[model samples]
Target chain A: MDGFIFSLIIGIFIGGVCGYLGTLMLSRKMALTAGPLGHLTLPGIALSLIYGFDVSLGAFPFVILGIFLIWLFETRTKLPMETLTAVVFASGVAIAFLFLPVEQAETALIGNITRVDIYGTIITSILCFLIFLIIRKNYHKMVLINISEDLAKASGINVRKNNLLYLFLIGILVSLGVRMVGGLLTAALFAIPAASSRNFSKNLFQYTNLSIFFGILSSLLGILIYKFTNLPAGPLIISVSSLIFLISVIFKR
Target chain B: MGKLKKQVLKMFAKDKKIILKVKNLTVKLDKEEIIKNLSFEVKEGQVLTILGPNGAGKTVLLKTLLGILPYNGKIEWKINVKIGYVPQRVPFVKQIPISVREFFLLKTTKEEAEKILDKIGFEKRILEKRLGDLSSGQFQRILVAWALVKNPNILLFDEPMTGIDVKGKETIYSLLLKLKKERNLTILLVTHDLNIVFKISDYVICLNKYCMCRGPPIKNVTPKTLQKLYGSKIKFYAHK
Candidate 1:
């Protein structure tokens, strides 16, 4: 009972952070970027296993590396973000499968969230919340450029500075989110609640706040459902968030 | 001779304040140059309207002037001068709900945004209305209000009246004249409305990948001049 309760608390913290990062991504319309960020953590996890380092530490640097590569890929080619996302995701999954030694690969692939200690959960929550604060406070400035870069620049908002800051924050958010929810399901936690609340909220701030509320509720309930029943935590959490999103859609003003 | 020289000097004296200047400006996309060595200077309190066809790089020039596009040029001025820009349209994506007042207040206070919105003839009720619900004309006015609230020294507008109704266009033109008179602002308006351009512009520049003709409006530079600048296929109607 104690273990399950502890896990639920960690899950809720992770969900809130993912919700915040997802809000930033949705507002920026960079949903495709979230995919590579989630998957690219796999190789890092595998490396950490082989070297006996904490998996997240290994995952952190590589995720930042992957972000720069994605930026470079975008600058070099005019390829659509969806295409890039698929390529990065496939590569990460393939590499993790090939390198992580057959015995451990299964747990690593599906994510061993049950094994995450309190320390890991605390670190993930802190990192995610910090990123949320950075993006949230500067959201007005970010939206200005997101709407129209030209208009923003003319109005004295620095476009390059904002872009770099946003990208860096995204790197940190994705790494922490993947650590908590597993790579494949992390994107869901990031997107679903935010996507659901979008119609109901009248402005950026409200949309983000509602998303966070939904995210925390879904995470707590999901863990509870999994603990009581034998159902998976990830899918349970996602289902709750998706249900909320559907409700928002049905009753959208 | 000394008296005559003094009089000539007085006649040639120009305003020391330079609102904006572009020298040897060149812009390219996919290796094709859009703005080729374009040069111009806008003085304080003057309106410079750029008139060109759809693909004549009119928007490109405006984007370059605002430093939006990557270009090769020497921009002599445009630092520390508060600038307001109104794009052709704001795309509705995400349905992010924001009232008209909150929208304008993205950069400033609600009180200041309301003051500008009032100047643009929007009522207080319009402040609480969702931006998505506003008509195209009303939305354009809101955009202008957003720019006006900045209290800008220079205003750059990209096809402000392109998709607006006739009444909206009239309101915008009159607003430009009023803004110039009231704020003493230097305005650079990009448009295809050559007739309207003549009506509100202090000077008109006919552009076709380059500056074809630039001078004060005159009846001498009639439809024939426009045809010569914008190709023989172009049509122009005289505005009373």
Candidate 2:
């Protein structure tokens, strides 16, 4: 496949996974956390760039650590996720700057599709599919946790363990997703499709399906636009995502 | 003490109607004690209400029994007794596109949800409606229906009537009465409303940081217990 086509296929797969994860964040009202988490990838990318490793592999551990800290703070302090996200992300970024060289910041912030290969694409596809199966199976349990931990516990669900598991799942999505959308706009990949679909869905299933559809569409279109225009693929994808959201809002109104 | 209680619980092993028993329950949060030494027993097919003021740790106590919070106590339950909980408020964000039917399907099958909603005085039409669109009373009924879909033998409610008005409370309580009679279910509810205590509770637990008084409302509830709970002089009236 040509570079353009290869990039397009990879972008759609990544965006779809992001969209799926975004629905949970939006429903759980933790979408904003994704923004800082995306930025927090800087240190990992910096280390990987310095060491000649893949960006995703470099960024993985820190994302997992960030999620762990957020989950711990939330349960212990009973503070809202929004507040915890801010604290965690701010500290994460501050530390990231320590390791990240200034010159490579732009390259790290705007993802380059030329970096993706057949091996990376195959691996990402497998990971995304595996994540999908897991999320589908646990959708109800996670929703129960989202609504009320008390209710989930009352129904004999393991609230704490499942909650931590969910954070880990989102953590994986962030590590994989930041490579395609770039650290700056990685979160938009999760939030935009979900926000758009929320305006159009009549039920939960429709909401999820529509979000995924939009995810694939925005990703593919964004890559096409970037290839022709020679613009940054990350911002191009976010623009398309935003346009879809605006259209949905109009339809909802 | 824990060992003795476990032995006693094993001794009461065959008494299936004793749905829940908590002995010397204690809960602490953020290194501060929220629930002090508390003990309570709930029998099958009884309405037990935990009455207390704000910050009296009623929520903390209910959560402790449900195992949602770590507690230093023995909470023994009759074997295989399923529980359903209806929180005073759930975090929906009021924007997620979810129907009542879809929400119920989260934990139960469609047929189960239909029957539960029917029992909760909702018509089949309401199932397709968005949860965000439901009226306060309707939403409250749906909360009950959501729990019923779990097919629980016991229901634990934490401030189930928090945002409901007086008229709405009446409708909800009536539904509770009807369900209790029809299903022979056990109920443990936490509330700050004394009037509700007199009207519906078979047993009242006046709690402030811990259980102040616990017994049949008529025999054990008095002006002194009310004062101890609310720290305010109040007139007493029972639903005749």
Candidate 3:
């Protein structure tokens, strides 16, 4: 496949899955969590830049560590997950700046989708499919837990275990998102489309479907624009999603 | 002949079977005790109502029984017992886009959900409405229906009538009584309505951070006990 085609395929897969997962996050009012977690991938992105490895691979470990810490603190303390994430990610960004190459900073801050090879595309597509399946299976349980922990517990849903798995999934998705939209805008890759979908959706089924549709549309549009304008795909993708969000707001029923 | 009769009566009492036993449960949050030195037992197919004023840890006690909160004590449920819970408030439901149908289908099959909704006297069309759009009464009924869909042996309701109006309250109480009778369910309900306590509950526990009184409602829930449980601020009137 051509370079742009490879990036387009990967972007489409990532966008679809992120949008699906983002519906759960948005419903739980953890939509903004994507932002800080996106930032938390900075250290890994910086390491990837230095070591000549895939950015998503480099971003994985740090985001996972950050997610684990946030989950642990949330269970132990009364503080919310978003607050804990902000604290952890800020430190991560600071550490990232110390080691990141100044010249290649743009690549870390805003991703280079064109750099993705055929092998990378194949691997990411499979990963996206797997993530989508796992999340789909646990989607209802997570929503029920969000509604009421006690009710979920009584329903025989293991709240703590499910929450940990959810956070881990978010960590994985955020890491992959870093390669598409860069560390700075990775949250938008998940959040904007979901938020846009929520405005007009009458039910969760509609909301999730619309979110996935918007996600793919934004990705395809962003990649096309990148091909023509030679602009960064990350910002373009977010810009397209934001445009959709604004339209959704205006046309909200 | 008298000794044989006494033994038979003892065997009958034993056959009732204690389904739940809580021994000296102490729940502390942030090193402050919420439920202290509390002990209670519930037999199968009995309705146990917990009555208390605000901040008396009634909700906390229910949560502890469900094993949601950490408690230092023994809470033993009979093996193979399934519990269904309806919480006091589901504040987040108002903002989500989940339909009533989706909420029910989360933990139950569509057929089971439809059956429960019908049993609760809700129209089939109501299932299409958004959970956030339902009136307080409808939402409460939905919560009840959600709990019943699982066919649990026991139900835990934490202040089921908190936001409901007077008429809705009547319906909820009557519905609870009806469901209890139909399903032979053991219920642990936390509520403040003293009037219905006598009407529905087989047993009542008046609590104020500790167990103030516990027994059959008519025999144990007196005006004096109400005073001790709620302090002199609450005036007790025996509803005929």
Candidate 4:
């Protein structure tokens, strides 16, 4: 596939996954945590540098581990979930700086979606679709789980297991999107579309459809701009998405 | 200690007719006793209104039964019933606008949700309006509809009438009574509205740190019983 087409496809997959995860984060009131999950990818990439492994593969474990640590600190400590996420994210940047050369670190920060392989993009698309299906099948249970932990248990939701599954899926999405979009702007991929879609749609199905549409449109526009203007892909995509959001808000009333 | 009671649960269970049975039940929140050694059972086609003063642990007791809080005791109840629960409060955010139908549809089918709204005497147009724009009474009614959509064999409501006006409360009570008769549902509702409870409840369980009084309403309810349940400072007036 051509570079622009490949980038747009990957963008749709990444954006869809991000938008899905973003809905949960928003509902759980844990949107801020997306920052740390995104930023923490730095250490994962840096660790790949030290260990001689695929940066994406190496970063996956660290991101998952970071999720676990985040969950632990969040549950056991008095600090808010957002504070823990920020601390971990900052620490990840520090750790990455200590290990990676300045040149690679800069590339990691800015992100280059053009570098993602066609095979990798296809794999992400399949995985994102699978995750979406699982969530759709269990929509009732997911809402029950989010509304009240206790009620979920009473209703036989297996709250702990479902929560772990959700976070793990999110971690995988974060690592994958980070590899393609760059860590700094990857979280925007998750939050912006989901937030905008929520304002427009009420039911979960409608919300999911609108979110996916917005995500794909933002990516296509971003990639188009990058192809024509040589601007960075991540920021371009996020900017377009943000503009859509602004327009939606303006006409919402 | 009260003997462990295994009464027949309502439609949710195989035996049918028993809602809940507790044996030596005790609940503590942050090391403070909320419900102390309480036991009771609610039968099918009946409403059991739990009456208590402020901070009397009525809410705590309901939460414990719903598996929200940890407690020490034996609770033998039907596990098969699809339980419908309405909490004391619904988090309202001005930014997130949800419609009455959208809210109920979160847990139930569209046809059933529409039926519930219709049964509540609301105009079909209410389904399309945003929840943020709803009056307090309308919001509570929608919450009830949400709970009703589940068609629960046993329904547990915690102050479902709070924030509702008198007319709204009357409509809710009448609707609940109709539902109870039609579905033979076992309802354990916690409310400070003793008059309404006295009128509709088949049984009343008055609690103050423990099960102070429990039996068929009026025939077993008295001011002395209220004093025992809530101390002499608090009193229970007869349902006129």
Query: Highest lDDT among the candidates is held by which one?
Result: 3
lDDT per residue for candidate 1 within B13-124, as digits (tens), equals 5445666778888889889988888898888888888877778888888777777788998765544567778887566423456677667767889889878777878789
Q: A1-253 in candidate 4: lDDT tens per residue?
A: 6767777887887787677667766766766666677778888777665665565676688788788789889778969776887788888778778877776775467567776667767877888788878777765666666655655665557787788788887788888777666777777887888788877875566666777788888888888889999988888888998997887787654
Kindly report the fnat of each predicted structure, to 2 decimals.
Answer: 0.53, 0.83, 0.74, 0.19
Residue lDDT tens for model 4, B152-210: 88888889788888888888888788878888877888998877678788888888887
For residues B51-106, could you state the per-residue lDDT of candidate 2 as single tens digits?
88889898888788777789897888776678888887886736677889888888
**CAPRI quality level assigned to candidate 3 from its DockQ score:** medium
Clashing pairs in 4: B8-B18, B9-B17, B9-B18
Q: Which ten residues in a row have the lowest lDDT in candidate 3 chain B?
A: B4-13
- Per-residue lDDT, model 3, residue B229, is 84
Worst 10 residues of 2 chain B by lDDT: B8-17
Error of 4 at A32 (Å): 2.1
Q: Tell me the lDDT of candidate 4.
A: 0.76
Give the deviation of candidate 3 from the true structure as CA RMSD.
4.3
For every candidate, what is the interface RMSD in angstroms?
Answer: 2.2, 1.5, 1.1, 3.5
Please give the lDDT score at residue B128 for candidate 1.
78
- Sort all candidates by TM-score, best to worst: 3, 2, 1, 4
Top-DockQ candidate index: 3
Tens digits of per-residue lDDT, candidate 3, B81-183, equal 7888889998788667899999988987889999989999999999899999899998999998898876889989998888789999999989998988898
Relative to the true structure, candidate 4 reaches a TM of 0.87
Rank ordering of all candidates by DockQ, starting from the highest: 3, 2, 1, 4
Off by over 4 Å in 3: A72-77, A80-82, B1-13
- What lDDT does the true structure give each of the candidates? 0.75, 0.83, 0.87, 0.76
